[model samples]
Target: MTKEQPIGFIDSGVGGLTVVKEAMKQLPNEHILYLGDTARCPYGPRPAEQVIEYTFEMANFLMEQHIKMLVIACNTATAVALEAIRAALPIPVVGVILPGARAAVKATKTQQVGIIGTIGTVKSQSYYQALKAKQQEITVTSLACPKFVPIVESNQFQTAVAKKIVAQTLQPLVHKQLDTLILGCTHYPLLRPLIQNMMGDGVTLIDSGAETVSEVSVLLDYFQLANPNPLKKRAIFYTTGSTALFDEIATQWLPITRAQSKKIHLGGTTNEI
Candidate 1:
């Protein structure tokens, strides 16, 4: 593979843009190709087999474009599909969980950590496993905020109603005595303000996507895949859902100018990129 090849990233929805935003900042010279399966979003509640199928579908599509590396930006997908995809693909693969877990381990002073994510992610206990692997004495409290993805995907994360929902959903963890909380899903960072307000001032919120990009940087260097020269167009976004909504959210969250998000259909031999 050549250095100019774009790194590929796949997510359940626009939530993965959170990771893309960080990649832009941390790896400024690399081109990025991102896909969001917004058409079948909230993969959190779906069966593991289905999530795996969909994740590979997205990963395979990016592989066709000859990406130098693959970042599984969805927590649910990473929990279920990271290993299989890594074994099957030729390129390097990175997932969000381990990095986020490591960050939480580093930030926690009380050895107590809280995790909030989608149902699938919570059910998989991926964060709990990763955190314990890092620090056996760490205390973890995990919750599934299934309502969150819809709010972010619908572009309602900043609304008053969104705040109410976040407050209500996070009430269970208020007294958990956590000094650090890992926003286990990429989408959760968009609601960072509300989550921080609900969790109060003592708790540090870990954006897993940001941490994942750090690993991606290291991997690029280790694999000798860092792009020496950037392309004129730094990023291309694709979604299985509405391109307009994807473009709108990308504009607000990304550092790029005139973010062009296109539509992509999975399970087909041909697609529009």
Candidate 2:
């Protein structure tokens, strides 16, 4: 695969932009094609089977774009669909869970680590499994913060209501005295300040998006897929839902130009070009 072929990234919504932001910083010369399934936003509450189907639909769409590689940017989708996507696709497929888990284990000074993510991610136990695979003695405490994604997507990170909801959702995990906290979901990083304030200064906040980018860097090198043009990279964003809302939030959080979103029907007779 040549570097001219864009890297593909897919998420249930705009959350994957966090991963794309990190990739822009790390792999500046590599063009990227990001797809956001905004029409069916919040894969957190969906059944595992439905999530898997949606994930495949998006992955196949990206494959149709001739993406050189695939990055499953959504934690819920990664948990439910990474393996299947990897098996179905010819290119290397990377996901956030394993990299984040490895980073969490490496950053933890104490054996006790805390994780907060969507219900689907937490239920899948992907982080717990990955952490245990590295060190059996490490203790993992996971909480399902289903409301956090919507709050960040709505651009309400610093609002009083958002803080209140965060406090309520994180109260259980805060009581566990964890020295390190992993922001399991890509959207959760936007809530870092609020989460850090609530968790205090001592707890280390791990952004999975950042770690996932590092893994992507390593993979690109291993596969000899690094772009030759170090300064001529471009990142493009697409969404199946509200382009206006995605553009508003993306401009505020990411350093990319305006996203050109196109409407897509799930499981219908429409093709993404």
Model 2, position 47: C-alpha lDDT score: 98
Give the least accurate 10-residue stretch of model 2, judged by summed lDDT.
Answer: 264-273
* Tens-digit lDDT string for candidate 2 (158-251): 7999999988888887778899998989888888889998998989998888889898889888999888886554877778878788888888
TM-score against native, each model: 0.98, 0.96
Clashing pairs in 2: none
- lDDT by residue (tens digit), candidate 1, 1-273: 999999999999998899999999999999999999999998999999999999999999999889999999999999999999999999999999999998998899999999999999999999999999899999999999999999999999999999999999999999989999999999999999999999998999999887899999999999899998856888988889999988888999988777778888986653775
Q: lDDT, candidate 1, residue 154?
A: 96
In order, candidate lDDTs are: 0.93, 0.87
Best by lDDT: 1
Q: What is the lDDT of residue 39 in candidate 2?
A: 82
